[model samples]
Structures are given as C-alpha cells and as structure tokens.
Target: MTENLDPREGSLTTRPTAADRARALLDPARCRGLVPHDAGYLQTAGIEIPATRGFGQQLMRTRFYAGVYQLGRPIGLRVASALQAPGRDEDRARTARSLRLRPGHTVLDIACGPGNFTGTYGHAVGRDGLAIGLDASHPMLRRAVADNPGPAVAYLSGDAENLPFRDGVADAVSCLAALYLINEPFRAIEEMARVLVPGGRIVLLTSLAPGGRRDRPHVMVMERLSTMRMFGRDEITDFLRALGFDEIEQVTAGLAQTVTATKR
Candidate 1:
C-alpha cells in the first residue's frame, strides 16, 4: 500500500509525476523491494564509511566475499573441486525439487545473492523459464551478472519489503539465506504473497531452530547475526499464514529449513 512520492514534494502536497515515478522506478533502491525504505536505501546510498567499530572493515570483507561467491564459475568450480560438506549438496537439491520449478515458470529470487540458488533455479525452470534475481547490493548484483551472464536470467537491485513488480506477476518467489536481514520480514512476506499468482509457490530458506546446527562457527555466527531481527520456524509459518498463503509447510534439509507456502 505504499504510495509513490517525489523527493521535492512537501509532506503530502504534490503527487509524483510520471517522469519522477519512472526515475524512481528505475532507481536501484526501488529494485530492492524492501520496507522501511530508509534502511535499504541508506545501506546502498554510497555513503562513505571510514574504518571504525569494524563496520567498514566488515563491509570490505563482505564485498570481497560477495564478489567471490558471485562468481558462478568459481562457485561451481569450488563445488566440483571438493565434495560438498555433509548434506550440503543434498540440501540444495532437495530445496530446488521442493519448489517444483519447471519449464514456463517465472521466478523472482528475492535477495538472491550472487546467483547461488539462482543457478540451480535456472536449471529448474529450463530455457523457456525466466528467473529475476532481486537484491539490494549493487556490487553483489554486478558480480552475479558477470558470473552468470546469459538469457532467461536477469539481476535486479531492489528491496523485498516493497517489490516493484505488479500484482500477481510471478509463478514462484524464492529468498535464500537473505530474508532474515530485513527488519520488517513479515511485510516482505506479504509483498511476496502479493506478487505471486494464485497457487504460486514461495520458498524461504533459513536456519530455523528446529533444524539443528552443524557446529560450524561461521554458520553459527551468520545465523546469530540474522537472528537479530529474524523469526523462528513457527513464527515464519504463522506470518505466512496470516499473509494468506495456503498449504504452508516447513521442510528441513540439513541445517537449513525451507518454508514452503502457496498463494491462496
């Protein structure tokens, strides 16, 4: 229900012009599709940050890590280079199958980081299918585009809380390892529900409490960080149900659980 407004307009005086709306629509910030526009916008608004409290250093490292992970070839190479840690590969495969992605399905990958699951999703949908990966991080999206350049795949810089897409525009919506970052997770879920066509599916991959951890420090740390504003399995299921999703179910694969819901 968020309305488009121009930056120059007084509190509620003037409405956004078509040109302004188009520009805003094209803005990368709009692409994130998240709520609390301030958070996602500020995070990517090119504000210079000096190294302090480890935040700047962390950002650097994250950019680097994201860059490396975004490299689809390297990602595949790494996966191929060594056997996936116990249940890791199996988990991904299981999640993809659970989504039932097939030819002709149009997918919207919210918070798709470096096309990790995006690649698997591409295969699931086949050539006729379309996969749009939306993310707030431009650097990350750039890497994704560079690594996995091809037809039927597009990278969008947008938030999840307020998706830019029209109503009921996608057959499936998927967010992997990134949904927990949004301060308003439920709002994003509602938007996901809005964008999906009737009977369309949505998959949210996260480290739900019911899914026991594997004693990996990095994994634990990541989960802890995400938990800052994230919800547990029950909370997610309830939220999705409240958002009008039907047949909501929690499916576990290794340390991660995929919350599956269908548009009512």
Candidate 2:
C-alpha cells in the first residue's frame, strides 16, 4: 500500500506525520526480516528517501510497489523469461561454453534472480559440484529454491557487495544482468575476486553504453528510480585489470555486454 501522506503536506516535505512513522515501525515486512533491519525509520516510512542507497533497500522500502512484484513474482519472472528467452538461452550457452565447467567445480551465481542462469550453472557443474544462487530479495530466493531444486543447487539471501563465502573458495563466479543495480560495483567485483580461486573465471552480463552514451531514457529512469548506472566496456576492463584479472574479453549483445575474465 502507498504511504499515508497528509493531504495538506507536499510530497517533497521531509517531515512525516506521526501515523506515517507508526505505520512504518509496525510494518510486518520490516519485522519479518524481509527488509534490512538497520534501515532508518524515515526510509521504512517511505518518506524523504535518499538517493545514495542500494536498489534492494529502495525496493524493500517501497515493498516492491505495494507488493505488486512481490505478490506476482512467478508471473513477473515468467514474463521476463519469455521476453528474454532467446537472449537468455544464448547467454547461458555462452557462459557454459566459456566456463567449461567440470565435475566437482564449485560455482557461485550472484544476483541469481529466479535461478535463471544458476540452474544452468548447476547442471554444468553436475551433481558433484555445488551451485549456489545468491540474491538479496527474499521472494526471489524463494522462487529460486522452488524452481531450481537439486542436491547440487542451493539458494541463499545475501548482498552482492558482501558475499557470504570464504576467500578463493569458488571455481567460478557469475553475475548476470545485475551489476548496474548495485550501489558499489567495485566492492562487489572485489568480493567476487576474493571468493574466486586463482585462474578462476568471472562472468558478468550487464547493461552497457557504447561510446559513453549514458543519456538513454531507460538508463536515466533506472538511475532515478533504482540508483542504477551504466558502465562502459573499457571502464569494466580497467576494473578487472586493477583487481588482478587478465585475459578480459567482452562480447556485446544489444544493449548488454558479456564479459569474461580470469583471476590471476
């Protein structure tokens, strides 16, 4: 439900009514651990939210637009899958080919929404290997757990910037179509590097602007609504190189790019 705002007060007003604060404090989602516990009361109240925060936090504060996406997660994911079926299949095949996964190779899939690529990774790794799909959204994790069931596949709720894994524990790590949504892309990349073994592959697929064109309408909307920002090919390569990654290769498909690098 939308926040209960006073009729006399303008939308931009920083001061929230007592009822608004009370409603935010009593929201079940916040207490149920669906949202971050440390979020400020004003944020939870959906008033005067700052722009310098993670997309997950912003989504949580809004309850995914009054539970529209949350309630219809399966349908939303199905629609997304249908719309991107060909591209998603191609990306998965490319990733599978590039990673050349073997039996008993541990793989981590960050921001693995609905286990789209995570299941592919699991099958690639086979039963002997582990495939963990990690995402910050609880509903997404639930969908992933329900849809991608296997002994080798598991789902965990975790932040991409701060992965919940030991150092150099993975044979491969992948983050597909999600880096742009992260507030701290560098930190997330560093975490991916930290969890990867030497020579392990890191696969990333994300929206990119060719020739530094960041003025696209969709990009601007995402920036305003979710704090997302597009990256260039060279910018990403530089980040990878600085983090000890080598042999970086980028392949563009439409507005997104698939980047594969090896940890050195």
Candidate 3:
C-alpha cells in the first residue's frame, strides 16, 4: 500500500526525538518505514541488503560521515570536473530542470547519500508526495535521517541494483553521481526504468571515460583505487534508448555527465 508521509511542502525539518516521529512511522507488525536512527528505515519482513558498496561509502561511518561528505564532496567533484568539461555547480541546476516535479509525485533517488536530494524532492512534491532514498550504507542513511528529516521523505538501506519497490511506483527516478559505484550499473538502470511509470522522467549523473578510454594509465589507476565503473559516452545513452526512453538530453560537466530522458 502507498503511504502518505509528507506533512507539508516546506523547507527541511529539524531533527526530532525518536519517540516524536515513531508515532507516525512505526507500525507494530511491519515496522517497514520509520526514522533512520530508531528503526533504520525500511527493515521489513523479507528485505535483505546483501550487496556491495563503493569504497568511499564503505569507509564512512557516523563519527565523521557528515563532516566528510559536506566538505569533501565538492572537492572531489571539482577535481573530477577539472579533467573534462570544467564547469561549476551544474549538477543541481541540470537535475532541477530535468525533474520538473509536480505536486504529489513520487521520486526515487537511487544511491542517495545522506538523503540530501531526497528531502529536496519531498519539498518539491509537496504534502501528498513521497521521496524514497535508497543506499546500501548504514552510516549514510543514519546521517541522512539526522540531517534531512521529513514526513514525506523515507530513507532505505538497500542495494541500488536490487530495489524493493513495485513496478511503476515512482513518477521520476534519479541516480546522481553514484551509478558508477554500483557493481552492476546496467541492472540498476533497468530496475530504475521498471519502477518508473511510463512517461516518467529520469535524471542520471555518472562518470564518462575520457574519450571513452579506460585503457589509459591515469584512468586505470583511478579505477583500481576507487572501483568506479567508467562508462563510455554511448554506453548509458544507448542503453536508455533501448529501454524505450526518448527526448534524451545530455549535459556534460568535466568528467561527469547528466542525462535526462522520458520513459516511453
């Protein structure tokens, strides 16, 4: 059954005590979706998240997670961007334009670290909407719950490649700057397409190989260090086309690319 969790269409909410939010989230039998700290988000009856995560995410924990993410993310992006398109904070603008969310829309943010974008999605969707953020890291989810609390937003600890939601559950799907971290990115994209309603749009940001070259020394070195999948230009674009997506638009900033398309 679809849950209506959002209390309003507003800015980020302050962190409340576990007992405060538990009244709305905890169902005695299912306990499926609750606050991240108290119930660890979606710990339902049959769910098991036995999947791999990126080395950086695996290395982060509650102690220093927030600091690292808030401080380090931009630096990393800047360095990566320096290698290719060399633009400033284009991710936020590109995504905001592509999503074009209306009230009550459900947006699934795959690999949503810290639920940052997820909460924004919730605000965009307004009172009768849902924004589900799925990530395989426990620390990330916990931090997210602390930082980005909302009635409309829910965080789940799960694999991006193996989502738990039913088909056509979301109006829009997004995988930002993290698709390359998944062990099976193509499978993850397929699952994203499956869960989205036809005509629903998708926004993706991932690393593209320089001149589609992974055989280069520097690229190989970085790949060995981070275990990030470097995609070719046509790789994801072609895959989306085959998956029956249209109106494909790609915006490149440095080594990363943002792709927006509608599911046919």
Q: Name the best candidate (by TM-score).
A: 3
Give the per-residue lDDT of model 2 (tens digit) for 6-121: 56774543443322322332324322322323221111222121243665445643534423543454344334344342444665777877776777788888877667677888
Work out how many backbone clashes candidate 3 has.
Answer: 3
- Pitting candidate 1 against candidate 2, the one with the higher TM-score is 2
lDDT of each: 0.60, 0.65, 0.72
> Residue 138 in model 2: shift from native, Å?
0.4
Task: Provide backbone clash counts, one per model.
Answer: 13, 0, 3
TM, every model:
0.64, 0.67, 0.79
Q: If the candidates were sorted by their lDDT against the true structure, best first, what order would they fall in?
A: 3, 2, 1
Winning candidate number (lDDT): 3
Q: lDDT at 246 for candidate 1?
A: 84
Query: Which pairs, if any, clash in model 3?
Result: 5-151, 6-152, 85-254
- Which tens-of-lDDT digit does each residue in 129-192 have in candidate 3? 7777877777777777777767677777767776766677688999987888777889999989
